[model samples]
Target: MSDEPLRIVHCFRSPVGGIFRHVRDLAEAQTSAGHLVGIVCDSSTGGVHEDRLFEAIAPFLALGVTRTPMQRHIGFGDLAAARRTLGILHRMKADVLHGHGAKGGVYARLFGTSMRLGGRRVARLYSPHGGSLHYDPRTMTGRMFFALERMMERFGDGVLFVSDHERRTFINKIGEPRGRTTLVYNGLRDEEFVPVEAMQDAADFLYIGMMRDLKGPDLFIDALADTSRTTRLPVSAAMVGAGDDLPRYREQVRLLGLSDHVRFFDPMPARDAFRLARHVVVPSRAEAMPYIVLEALAATKPMIASMVGGIPEIFDEWRHGLVRPTVEQIAQKMREALDDPIQFAGLMPPAESLRARFSAGVMATAIERTYREALRRHS
Candidate 1:
């Protein structure tokens, strides 16, 4: 241990999505700061996307790619994969195990707890990234998630919530001890996010993210459809990012005869995708801190998003952009946003200020401090 750099392992079920992006950013930051970083994730099957994620980070550090044979569904395969992950942890001799999301968090906690019981000094950190806690408490799954949180709380040395709202929700629902939880806003390298000059001629609203049910891609289409009916403005919408629901969403667009008005593009590098749009929309049913919103804010693009999760914390009603409750509300906000030049201008200063707060340097420093603290605690 004395001769080695801090051996850090980031465990995630898949090396994709916003959580994966966060992990990549941290790994690069840690490597630059002179720490050894490694990642373990599921193997890529043919036709499986997210290969770009591995490609993006491989050149930066010593990455250990372990492919877990696990189906995403809740069954025997997942348990077998968890066992495989535990074996990997034992082999890696990781000093700190940082887990992202539900499956990763559970596996890391169990592994760390077992190691601690055996007199091994391994610290554990869990970043939920808005998993079970993101659901409304009225449902059965939400209740089960609450119970799971209680079960897992004892195993974690520290819990990091991406937003204050997420932390507050966790405290409110689970009654977990507040002292162990910390709020670490997701950060991105602002240098990578080149700002697009507000396009005076760009015609469509842009939505970039997986086209999953919770992301509300359909709602964006529906809102665009309604907006077209009410206004004479030739509004068009472009969606980038493919998912299991992409074909079904394509059918919905065709059934609405909106093939021309609504277009779907293959997911491109985030910077390239952001350059092609005028306004960004995040209509997710739930989120913790979406990197898309941070990227949009960093790009200084005006946005309209759902008033859920950490979104309201990111943007005030009349400050950065509008945050609405429903699709119709989002459409109403869009119409209002288009009509009000003064309000849009008012948003720029605050947006720019917000962008600086999430810069990579700031985030790296915060995370480094957290890592040091965790190490000190273990010592």
Candidate 2:
């Protein structure tokens, strides 16, 4: 493998959420390491916040940022989108085409293969990022997606999983990958390790993430209501984030008579949201090494999360303390957190252990090594 700088292009569907954060971290690290980096993602999704994030990283993206319309679900429109995306990528002449999520995976592997016919060397890599794998294999939708995953396995030089749980899901649903695979945990930056102090008037708890049901925003609301009802404690929360289901969650809050206690706010920085509340709650139904959990732990904030997806892996030995993704369980945990804040704080994983295993620099170095190996193998 050549030690010279290489062109790296990261392709993904949405310019929001964990996958976006992961790409941003990798892009920054790779650019700092003297490689040309670029991003191609859907234009329709993010708002001003995401635009600001793009602006911050725009200066370092040597290959430039490109965006176009991309539908979340598979449709006939994909043909045109794929053609346009392929043209953009081919023009970049990327040495490594790394895709995140399901649609991006298909585009990277299939389009990267097409680019190979043009007589240039290109390493195609795909990271599932808990995309289509979230679907159940027992359902027709799940069966179709898994079948697609099985078919696409042969096109890529490598498949990268963010967690062992994600890897296990792939094997169980689609069988073993025909191509190379590696597990790389999502990571945090050095500055993120500095603890965030709660504001003087912080609420009892914080619910920060997408407002969708899948992320359990409703569960957070229900848990708060239950905690207030069961304990008669003056429980309050700050719900931060935006999604299609945001209004629905607001209505649920109103109907449950939580309008006075639960205040909804637009999405903001996690650390900023952390300041709005004394404790953090990640009530996700599914995940693939969520960055929020790492950020919360690194900032020395006490948190309770659902025991689903790769969360247990993050918790490690503390995994036994994770609550199931249910209102009853979440409410119980919330009550415990409210009752003894110090005890809840004690459940946090040690900072040193998290830094060693989940640093952005380490993640970038390992991924860079994978890129080199994939390039050599493809060559």
Candidate 3:
């Protein structure tokens, strides 16, 4: 191998959600670190917002990007896309193949093994940023996904988990070798949080993320209904992000007579949404170190979140913010936060410190170290 900068190929299903942001940040950081970075993604299907967003971000980095007509869902198209990916990898001569999300992981393993078998020195790494493993095994789809994951282990050289809880849950579910996995937490750039002048008349609570069921948008509205019955503090809530469930959530808000108390905004740039409120609420049924939580912490905003996934790892006690298990508990915590502004202000410094530990720079260094280790093993 030459002493030239390591060439990396990053693969992801759709350039959306936390996975997209993570891959983008890593690619920018690697480019800055003097490495050659390239990205491979499914081509744009006209009118898809996520595809357009990906197209926008692709050209900003000092790397090449190749998009094939791959579908996210399993289909005949994906098989052809996999072959295209193999052809791209061969041409790029990538030293490392890094995959993000479920479809990306599948492609990386399938084609990466072919490269390895052909006596190419390419290494494979998969990052499952909280994929189907979060699904409860009581469902048939979840069980099948677990089995598929177990089968994929034979092809992957390393797996990067975004949270300790997720790593533990995955290891227990798939029985993968412990040595093959590493915990690489999701991180935020400092510019991700913009300070808003302490709004004297802003909304009392805010929720950011896709307006989907797993994100608990409906439960948040239900909690607001519960809070209004107990207190007449004139509380207001902001729900941000766009999803397939937006219409249903709007209907629920109207049914609960929360039309005046709750307002919905289409997803804006994240910093703009974070700066619009003082309190951030994460009522997700499941998560794996959501960037919104880290963003809230970076902005020194108080938070009330469900104690799920990697949330507990971010804050120890109520001093930083509150963590609970149910919608009722989330409402109680919000009420408490509204009552004690001084106590909430006391959480800022500690929260900032916690946020710094997971900055984008730290995440990039961890990933680069992993890439080097993978290369060494293959050598």
Candidate 1 TM-score, C-alpha based: 0.91
Candidate 2: tens digits of C-alpha lDDT, residues 1-379:
4779999999999988899999999999999999999999999999888998999999989999999888999999998898899999999999999999999999999989998988879999999999999998899999999999999988899999999999999999899888888888888999999999999988999999987888999899999999999999779999999999999999999999988888888878788888999888999999988999999989988888999889988888865348999999999988888888888788778888899889898899889999999888867
- For all candidates in order, the CA lDDT equals 0.75, 0.91, 0.78
lDDT of 1: 0.75
Extract clashing residue pairs from model 2.
none
Instruction: Pick the lDDT winner.
Output: 2
RMSD of each: 2.6, 0.9, 2.6
| lDDT score at residue 311, model 2, on the 0-100 scale | 90
TM-score list, all predictions = 0.91, 0.98, 0.90
List pairs with backbone clashes in candidate 3.
none
Task: Indicate the residue-level lDDT of 344 in model 3.
Answer: 72
After TM-score superposition, the amount by which residue 42's alpha carbon in candidate 2 deviates from its true location, in angstroms, is: 0.3
**Roughly what TM-score does model 2 have, to 2 decimal places?**
0.98
Q: What TM-score number comes out for model 3?
A: 0.90
Off by over 4 Å in 1: 1-4, 44-49, 198-201, 316-320, 340-351
Provide the clashing-pair count of each candidate structure: 0, 0, 0
Tens digit per residue, CA lDDT, model 1, 157-221: 88888888888778887776534776778887758556766455555578888878788888888
